[model samples]
Target chain A: MRAQFVLSEIWIGLRRNLTMTIAVIVTVAISLALFGSGLLINRQVDQMRGFWEGRIQVTIYLCNEVSANPQCQENGPPTEEQRAQIQTDLEAMPQVESVTYESAEEAWQHFSERFESNPALVDAADPEDLPESFRVALHNPQDFNQVASAFEGAPGVDNVYDERQILNRFFDLLSGLQNAAFIVALVQIVAAALLIGNTIRLSAYSRRRETGIMRLVGASNFYIQLPFLLEGAIAGLIGGIVGSIFIVAAKFLLLDGMQDYFQFATTLPISELIYVILLSIVLGVLLCSLASFISLRRYLRV
Target chain B: MVGSDTRHHNLREHAPVINFDNVTKRYPTQKRPALEDVSIQVEKGEFLFLVGPSGSGKSTFLRLVLKEERPNDGRIHVAGKDLARLSNWKVPHLRRRIGCVFQDFRLLPNKDVFENVAFALEVIGKPRRFIRKVVPEVVELVGLEGKADRMPDELSGGEQQRVAIARAFVNRPMILLADEPTGNIDPATSIGIMKVLDRINRTGTTVVMATHDAAIVDSMRKRVVELEEGKVVRDQSRGVYGQAY
Candidate 1:
């Protein structure tokens, strides 16, 4: 029954201050939208990260001259026995998945395919002079250092390169951008909370006389605080709804509609969109609830 | 209807509901005290009137008695709780023992008469079933049963005063403090409000009414305490308005 009274008072208060309520909703919506967008950017960065890691492989170049080094050297190409031993060692290792050995002729053919449009460059180069290379695959991409560690001083190897390091710098840049957005989102959320608090205070002031009369009529301070708290909560709920709308719109317009405009792409799962929307609602509820609590502390003191 | 007590009633041993001992109230912004060394007693079932002009601090006296403001100079006891020593949290409990009405009627303009009357009980965590049973009874007592669903604006001035009285008395407070309950109404309506106060006092509730109505005070011959410039000018057993007549 007491619950019914609180609910009834909240209902009347919401109906009474319709315009201010809408304003609060708009402020909360903008803040939560910024927060949700920040989260989405972070998730997108994570997805692109996994895609880049899967393709990062170590490239093993063979010697061009008849050097004694078994892996690679600038002076000479590897002997057939040395080449067979390297292939056997790579295949037998647990970390190694598969290694495709491209001979000098094959390497030249691969280069020709890349520059196929320019027939002049293809005819000018000698296929027999090109060095043989090993495109190495690994079971664990993060253990790329392990592959480099194993072949550091190998006999016939000229160089060992991992593509993953190049991709990491890009991830770092994206992470920095996401962090900035998060900080701004946090600031806006604090602003929204203060907005809610100020509005409640105004509401209290508008009816200051009535509050004094209620206090005179034996109404408890806790009882007086109930209506204002409910008013803040309802404002937050409306704000949450508006914020979720922005999140859904961003998902459709940016992620799907403009997919081809950007070079990198991702498939944002439906579950993730729903999670962001729910997160916006939770943030709205929590922020407004805190604002109402702080505002009531001073107002109810009198 | 005064109580059916032609027999000699012992007033002293009836347990005074409102007691003040040298209570003085000074506002923070004021250079002079609003109430000065005022000590008074009104027993349960006593009908008393506190009469004073504008600056005599009649409302401040009522506010002090209800624990709305603590006295700066001396001890004030209301319903057996000392105003100075009472915990801040228990202020509401102390207030519940006293009912108060205001000069402005101070009704929540949004709520209808029924909810307005129910508000007094609702704040104390009273059960809804009990509120339902009790609110209508007090509404009928104040002759506002027909206007239960009407908001404060929809009612006449006298009717609003009746609703305010109903709200004050619905909780069954032993001590009732009315601060010029009839100041805004006509003379005929003032008589009607006085009748309501008289009816409540006849039921063993101590009532203290602050007013400047000369005819009503002189005719009733009730106990009157008149104040001048924050000092009690006269405290009489059957006092009239301002000692003019």
Candidate 2:
């Protein structure tokens, strides 16, 4: 009987304030969707960082016949003695975890394999154009400068390049995007909360007569406030369900497109997206419930 | 008549169902206290009339009994429980034993007669079967029998007041507080409403009615407690709304 009464009350309240309810639902949906997107973006950045952590390296290209650098061109190709000395020096450095020499032929093969997804790009490159280099794995990716500075103008060196620098720039851009999403989501959530609070206030005002009678006849605070709380909760749940659709759409349209464009960047799987969706829904429900609870506080004081 | 069969009769004969001792209530916005150092005792099964002008603390007295407002000083005891010591959570339990009727009739406009009366039971978590059985009987008792399906707006002013009375009496509270229940209805209708309240009073329930209707008070000849400016000025048994006023 109580459940029926509460349900009926919720239905009545929702129907009575249809426009406000719809406004609350739409606001909550947009807010939770942005929230979920923020979570997904954060996850994507983490995944990319994890995938690249082990593979990042600093490459030192030797002075070869076809090199464009003034140091390499003037010196021509490094002698065998110069190559052995550079290799020994890199191996002795504390920051260098490991060093491996790649021949021009091997470099060509790796480049071809890396760009195999785009056969046209791989076919445009020649084996003779590739340079022989030492790929240095560092103890700490942040310590790339230590290795780069050591061999920058050393004999046989054409140019020293650290993959961390390029990867950091890319990760910085993703982090900025993630922060923007969070800030926007925060604003949306505040708007949603205010809307929820107003909806509850309007609902409470419309039902003041019932609540006054309820109080007179000995209805507990919970008993009197249950229907309003349920109204907010139902609005939140509906918003969450709608937001999940947005989240799924974002996964398919936004994240998937990103994955396709940046093939090496790892994006979230469906399972993780499902988790984020559930979390967003729960957050939406909590936000609305809290807002309504706050708005109904003065009335409950009786 | 709802809990007549199972109602407890263990209280001593001298014990009052409602007791207020030197209770003073002041609103922060108002200069004078609403009820200043006023006190009264109402025994079980008594029909009492609280008569006074508009701002004589009649409503405030009823609110204090229901623990709806806390007294600024002194204490109130209802049904042998000290209201000042009662926690906020226990206020509802205290209210369950005291039914309140208002001048406005305070009926939910959207609900029908039957639903309004049943609302009292439903809010307290009464079973559907029990509500079904008791709501009709109380509706009939208040003389709203066949009009159970009519909404509050559809009913006459008198009938609306009857529905409000039926809702108050449905819980079979030990103390019924009526704040000008007849204020909005005609004198003839007010008499009928009084009869219903008198009947409920005879059923071993204490009825405290605050009213401005002199004719009804003079005719009923019940206990009359008259207030003036937040202080009790007259206490008369079988009073006639007092000729001095």
Candidate 3:
């Protein structure tokens, strides 16, 4: 029954200071939602990496008679025995998942189809300009370095290269973006915390006499603090709901509808979006709780 | 001193709700002690008053009774317990036994007279049914029956003081300490507040009122302790307000 009185008083106090309570909720919601967005982007980047790395292939170009690159020292094409021997060596390696040898003509056709978007590059380059390559898919992408090292001085091998460097540059861009998001989230969270603290302090000050009278009337410390704490909590909850609605709207109207032009699918899904909303509520509670507690401690003698 | 060693023996079973013994209290920023070597005693059902001009330390004496401040030297007691040694943990419990009324009324602006009186019981965790019965009774005792739902600002100054007195006595506290219960009210309202307090005193509750109201003190002729510059100049039974008026 005593607990009920305390809870009821807290309810009344929050209702009395509805505006400041709403402010705290908005502060927590907006900051947490941004934090959640950064998290989602990081997760998407991880998914994309896992998807592409599984299909990545290691390529080894064979030396040709007309080639002048230092590693391709041979003046004539390799015999069928040499080709068979190379294929056997690659198949025997534990790291090599599969092997497919493409002749020079096949390599040229692949190049033409890949560069078909740029007619000038495809029309200007001859088929002979490209190399006859042996493509090897590895069970472990990390093990590509070991296989490339093994084929370093093999006969008919011009160069052994892994696609990891190209993938690294692409991943570097996404990683940088994720870092930028984290920095933005950090700065905004601090600002929100300070705002919450100040707002609650003002509210507590406005009702200073009330707090003192509560103490005189045998109100426990927790009882006196409950209303202010709830005030901030309600604010955080409201802010979270508002910010989450904005986030969902942004995902629908901006990220999803116009993503085809930019080809960036970093937008969070509806389920994940719901996860962000839940995150906002939790964030709102924690931030407002902290802010209100700190504010009450500083301002109210209780 | 009212000679009653037999009553003193009974006080051991039920503590004399307040005690002070050569208690001297000086504020941190003041040159003189706010209360100096003050010693007074009262039986469990006694009605008492502290009367003095402003700055005569009557307010300070009342504050000490409440343990809002501790004596810089000597001892102070309330409800048979040492107030000086009470930890922060015990302060609230000590407060629960005492009902205090301020000169300003200090009523909550948001609450109506019903809630105002009920608030005292509510803080002490009275059940809803008990509150529903006790609140109206106390409100009627203060003579504000029709004005139960009226806000503090809506009431006149005397009516607000009545509401405050109702709040103070609502819990049936062991002691009721009123600091200028009729300070802002007219003489008629002052008589009303005194009458209500007299009824509370009749109910075996100890009442200590601190005020400079000459007419009320002389008319009631209760025991009055008059102070001047932190010292008790006179202690009289059935005393008038005296020269300070």
Candidate 4:
């Protein structure tokens, strides 16, 4: 029966301050959505790193007659002895997990297959024109720097390249995006907290008379505050539901929409989406309750 | 002091509902204490009038009894519990045993007469079945049985006061405190309010009232404690409002 009274009080408070209540709901929804997006992006970056780190290799391109690299001028099409020596040194390095020697013919065939759709580029290339190289895979992909420095300026090597370096730049962009989203979400959360505080203060002020009577009638502090706390929690719950909807819409329209185009990068799974939604809802409810509690402490004596 | 203690002991045997022993209350912003070393005792089932001028500390006396404010220099015991010894958490329990009515009739404007009265029981977590049974009885006691559905704004000033009284008494408190409850209504309506209070007191509930209603005070002929400039100037059993002037 008392719960019924408190529920009715909460309803009356919300109805009386409908505009402010809506403002709180919308603010919390937008902030939680941004927060959820930030978490999702972090998850995506981790997944992409897991997918790419294993396959990334450091390529040591040996000098060839067609190579314009300065190292090739002194070597003159790289003697077989020089190539064998370079291959032996790469294999002996502790940073090198394993090295595969790709001859010019094999390099040409791999290149042709990669550009199979672009016949014009494949026709311009000759088997003898491709540089022979060693493809070195490190046990730890981050050891690319150690392997690259070891092979650079070697006798037969024309250029040292780590494929992971390119991928690192891509990941750096993603990390930057994640940080920006988190900052925006943080700002929005602060704004939402302030708005919730103001809304609660206004509600309390407008109902001061009722509270005064409640005090006179022997209402406990908890009894007086329960309705207001529930008011904030209800608004937060609605905001969480809306935010979850936004996250689901974003997953469908943005991530799942591009699933076929970016097959190499794995899409976030359903479990991740569910986790984000639940987290956003919990965060919303806690944020609102905390804000309301603070305002009540500062503004309402009871 | 020894004689007063013996007197208090005798009153305690009679179940003194309120005992104020040299209670003094001073507001920091004021130059003088609101209540100054005033001692009064009210026995159970007594109807007492606290008559005083605008700043004679009548309201302060009621507030101290309610535990709304502490006495700076004395002790008060209500229903056998020492006000100073009462913990903060136990204040609501103290208040639940007492009912208060104000000059403004402090009814929730949005709630109807029945809801306003039922609110008292609801806030204290009374069962729905009990509330359904008691609300109407109290409403009928205040002679507003048919008007229970009317909102505060729709009622006359006297009816509003009746609703306030019903809300206060619905909990069946051991004591009722009225601070100028009839101040806003006409003389005719003030009598009506006093009769309701008198009826509630007849049920063995102690009644303490602070008021400026000279006519009602003279007509009721109850015990009167009058204060002047924060000091008790008169204590008379079956007193008139003033010097019969």
Put down candidate 4 lDDT per residue, A1-302, tens digits, no spaces.
37778988899899999999999999999989888887887888898899888888889898888778887887777787888888888889887789999998899999999999999998987878888888988888888777778778878788888898787887787688778878988999999999999999999999898888888899898898888888888889999999888888867785666455556558789999999999999999999999999999887784
Off by over 4 Å in 1: A2-5, A47-55, A60-160, A206-213, A252-270, A300-302, B1-15, B84-89, B108-115, B122-133, B144-156, B226-234, B243-245
In terms of docking quality, model 3 is acceptable
Please write out the lDDT profile of model 2 over residues B1-245, one tens digit for every residue. 64653354434566788888999999999999999998899999999999999999999999889887889998899999999789998888999998888889988887899999999999999999999999999999999889999999999999998999899999899999999999999998888999999989989999999999999999999999999999999988899886655
lDDT tens digits by residue: candidate 4, B1-245 = 99999998886679678999998999999999999998998999999999989999999999898898999998899999999999987898999999999999999988899889988888888898898899999999988989989999999999999999999999999999999999999999888989999999998889999999999999999999999999998989899888643
TM-score of candidate 4 against the unseen true structure = 0.90
Could you say which candidate leads in TM-score? Answer: 2
| CA shift of A83, model 3, Å | 5.5
Q: Let me know the TM-score candidate 2 reaches against the reference structure.
A: 0.91
lDDT tens digits by residue: candidate 3, B178-234: 998888889987888888889888988899999988999999989899888898888
Stretches off by above 4 angstroms in model 4 are A65-78, A93-95, A120-129, A257-263, B1-16, B71-73, B243-245
lDDT, candidate 2, equals: 0.90
- Higher-lDDT candidate of 1 and 3: 1
Quote the positional error of residue A112 for candidate 1 in Å.
Answer: 6.3
Tell me the whole-model lDDT of each prediction, alpha carbons only.
Answer: 0.81, 0.90, 0.79, 0.89
**DockQ, in order, for the candidates?**
0.45, 0.62, 0.46, 0.62
Report the lDDT of model 4 for residue B118: 87
DockQ of 2: 0.62
